[model samples]
Target: MVETKLLMIDDEESFLATMEKRLSFRDIVVNSSSSGPEGLKILDENPDMDVVLLDVKMPEMDGIEVLRRIKAAHPLVEVIMLT
Candidate 1:
């Protein structure tokens, strides 16, 4: 009965909000960010995060770059890329 800790990174605010709501209902603890930098910051702050739902295309920093950074720093964290 352990709750999943998910970090969602997407440029679409609406999508993040909707996913957060739906996932919360399922007992997930969701932390959302609209940009790569912010998402990285969240990851730094929440070292216990289990998974990341990352959007492939975003401004400020692209998902690929974010993925690279995440893997470099938080290699144990799993990332699922979203189109």
Candidate 2:
């Protein structure tokens, strides 16, 4: 089976770092962003990522708003919300 690519977005840098390390161990191409803008950029750059793990609370742009844009921009990808 092919390893799926993933993106995890959160405002807390420490949390994103930890999750990145953990997910990478499973041979998945895991990328995490510490802000909504950065996450959007990642989504634009890697249009083929399989799933996105998103947090509901954020500063500049809330996860819900980010998720909305992400879905609008890339409807094919899967999204999992974490609060």
Candidate 3:
């Protein structure tokens, strides 16, 4: 079975850390960011990422805009938006 490589983007630091740990334990490789720009940077640096877990509300950039950018850059990557 192939491992799932995920990028989680959220403004909540504690949430990112907690989710990373829990998901890692389940054999999911999670890379996290505290903002949309940071998440985009991670995606650029790590093109192999399979999925993106994005928070719906953020300070600088919202999830929808981020999703647009992600789809524009890496259309194959799947995204799940969280509120």
Candidate 4:
């Protein structure tokens, strides 16, 4: 089976860390960011990411804007917004 590579972007540091750990246990490769710009940078560096789990309400940049940018830059990468 192929492992799922996921990028999780949220301003909550503890949530990111906890989810990363839990998801990693489920055979998912998890990368994380605390802000939109950082998430974008991660996407830039890791183009092969399968999915992005993004928070809807975030500081610096919101999920909708991030989703737009992600779609513009990497349309193939799937994204899910979390409230």
Candidate 5:
């Protein structure tokens, strides 16, 4: 089976940690960032990443704007927004 690479972006540290742990247990490769800008940077660094689990409400940069930027730059990557 092919491994799924996922990038999780959320401002909540606990949520990120818990989800990363759970996802990692399922054979998913998980990468995470606590801010939108950092998450975008991570995406830039990891172009082969498959999907992004993004938080809708975040400081410094909101999910909508991040989604716009993501689509503008890397249209092929899939993003799932969470509130």
Candidate 6:
């Protein structure tokens, strides 16, 4: 059995790193980006990604905007915004 692949977007590097490590230990494939645009890029680049854990606050594009874009591009993928 394989764990789900989760893409996490957060401006806080520490949180992302820690979550990635913990999930990785549980056999999840986790990729991370620090901003919305980069997460969009991740969606474009990794279309098969199973889910996204996005932070609500960010520098450039922000979480809602990123979510809008993500939904527009890949509506079937799951997204959970962490505020």
State every prediction's TM-score relative to the real structure: 0.97, 0.93, 0.95, 0.95, 0.96, 0.95
**lDDT tens digits by residue: candidate 5, 21-56:** 888878699999999999999999998889999999
lDDT tens digits by residue: candidate 4, 17-76: 899878877879999999999999999999999999999899889999999999999999
Per-residue lDDT value at 11 in model 6? 98
Worst lDDT 10-window in candidate 3: 20-29
Best by lDDT: 1
Using alpha carbons, what is the TM-score of model 3?
A: 0.95
Which residue pairs collide, candidate 5? none
Candidate with maximal TM-score: 1
User: In candidate 1, what are the lDDT values of residues 1-83, reduced to their tens digit?
Assistant: 89999999999999998998888889799999999999999999998999999999999999999999999999999999999
Full-model lDDT, candidate 4: 0.95
lDDT of 3 at 36: 98
Report residue 21 deviation for candidate 2 (angstroms): 1.5
The local distance difference test score of model 6 is 0.92
Alpha carbon RMSD to native, model 4: 0.7
RMSD of each: 0.6, 1.0, 0.8, 0.7, 0.7, 0.8
lDDT of the candidates, in the order given: 0.96, 0.92, 0.95, 0.95, 0.94, 0.92
Question: Against the true structure, candidate 3 has what lDDT?
Answer: 0.95
2 or 5: which has the higher TM-score? 5
